[model samples]
Target: MRSRRARVAVIGVVVGLVTLAGGCASTDDPKANPSPPAGGIEGTVWVANEGGHSLSVIDAASSTVVTTIEGIEGPHNVQVGPDGSRVYVVSGHASTVAALDATTYRLASAAPTGASPAHVVLTPDGQRTYVTNYDAGTVSVYRPDLTPSGTIDLGGGPHGMRPSPDGSTLVVANLKAGTVDLIDTRTDRKVAAVPVGGPAVQVAVSPDSRYAYASVSRPPSVVKIDLQTRVVAGRAEVPTAPAQVYLTPDGRSLLSADQGSKDKPGTALSVIDTATMTPAGSIATGSGPHGVVIDPTGRRAWVTNVYDSTVSVIDLPTRTTVATINMGSQPNGISYAPRPPAPAEPRMSVVLPSPPAESSHGDHGGHG
Candidate 1:
């Protein structure tokens, strides 16, 4: 979920409303033979430039901007297909999900969504896509080709969410209601809403799908909820108001992007030890750290500092930020697609779809 300052500061933030830099971002380590990336980064990090109304593609190994894809209106969130052939983006201003060809950066098709759309998440199998509608209180489902499937109403501002690794359940944060709702994937039906102590912003489901870690804005904390028992198991305090929660690949630690409000911006990324359910430590980053994704190796993480308009690359093993990439304004969301580019050259492409050209690519796959 985006911060209150962003929605207020940037109209495109689809923050429909509101809307970085660093004092602490760094460079390659010099102690040992420096690796291009701290933890041998791979793939690319796609960032949703909510204010800029574009997407910035970062080359992981080199930690540089390969390109900036433009022409989508107010993209708040972006998700890549498993094969890295497609990218799904939800625009709050357009109230639609635009599926674009990843390589060509062309809008393949677009499907309308609910009011005040927030985040977008695809099923692990990539058969289904879910978009959270904040004002309408529903989640819009779509086929891989961007065709409308159905809708699930959970009420009270459904914002950030994640599907379980097992592909059986979807856990979402209801910002307006201060609760988390679970949906059964097979039936697309409401499972349960477990209330936490504060406004739930974003979520990270455990690799096993047995637990969920929700980022709570107020009180600045992370609450661990047992998915099976449907209750709060533990709560850990963070440095500031966190936006996104991500679990390391090994599931040993949960990284919380401490994105404090613009009026009171935070400068750190909070870490929670999953086993002990306590604060592991904090990593200084750019201001208003928003979306975060860890590398497959679990040794590195990339964080979007919304206020600073920069990304901090964290070396997880040292609990430190090893690099920062300057980006377009107000980078709100981040996703890692673990596939190498064909030519691996820098690209700056802009796709403006004509009325008829805005159509779907053939089906990628059926529901698994």
Candidate 2:
């Protein structure tokens, strides 16, 4: 998303507030579900505060900032490790990734990565982590203990690294190259490279793992890829410049953050119905909507207005902006701690369950 002089200044201010201000689950949950609230405190959402150079911990249930961890430099993408033991944040400027203890939100360790590490993702076992190095055109794999495992050379600069549902493959978006590189997780080798929409910024996988979607910014479209065929399945256009793409918890909808044009600034959060790949509606928000996230129930979505220094809260059911809260500074990434479903009473066992098959599991340039 781009804007003129005044808008640019406003965007900077919003990002600054985000850095300075620094900023779930339920039981009654379901059978086989582990309530996020299983622990004492409410579930926590870990956000990488880019401008602030820190991490923010928010209680999902209260929607309140609980604590802040300082000393990070230009953190971009943040991911929670499997077992919920650690949170990994990538430093786009520092060329490093920080490991934080999940409970205390304290720095566990820091590992040097490739140039401009933009995002981080953990494996299903939380035993391995992948950091996308944009300028370096590589993906750095780290051990759960924060040790460097190895690096995979992607053709172009790599940005977003996401794991497949079955945990079998890791798909990365090569921003400048306009291709998605599939990595064999077990061997850390590039398996395939498939072209997609222009300037792929973010990637997401469907619940069924049959499709992988990448949000392309320049053309402002979401590119859907057929997992089996490795081909472009479909594309959905979004207005203006689409930044972050979020999938509803129930996997029924896709939300695009449309940071508006120069004069008007701000943005519009476009809601797309996944069934038809069509936009359902849009909610106006502060200037420069950068990142977005949905509540576990898929009932509400929270968006960060990078230029306005506020968060627009959208009521999914009503399809409107119900409230706007000042978050101070540029908020980049948003996530919620989904509460585990309530536990069900154990009945007499009919038969022993078989173990399910194990699974596996961009870009660009300038401020333009």
Worst-scoring 10-residue span by lDDT in model 1: 359-368
lDDT tens readout by residue for model 2, 1-368: 11122322432232221122222011111132212321232355555556555555555544444455566655667777766766777765455677766654556887777766668888877878899866567888888887898988885657776788688889787766777778889899998888985766677777777777777665677777887899988888877666677787666788887764334454687777777778788777777776777765677777766555455666677777655554424556765555421222221111111212220001211121
lDDT of each: 0.75, 0.63
- Give me the candidate number with maximum TM-score: 1
TM-score of 2: 0.77
**How far off is model 2, as Cα RMSD?**
11.8
> What C-alpha lDDT, on a 0 to 100 scale, does residue 50 get in candidate 2?
62
| Residue 363 displacement in candidate 1 (angstroms) | 33
Cα RMSDs of all predictions? 7.1, 11.8
User: Counting only residues 3 or more apart in sequence or on different chains, how many pairs clash (N, Cα, C under 3 Å) in candidate 1?
Assistant: 15
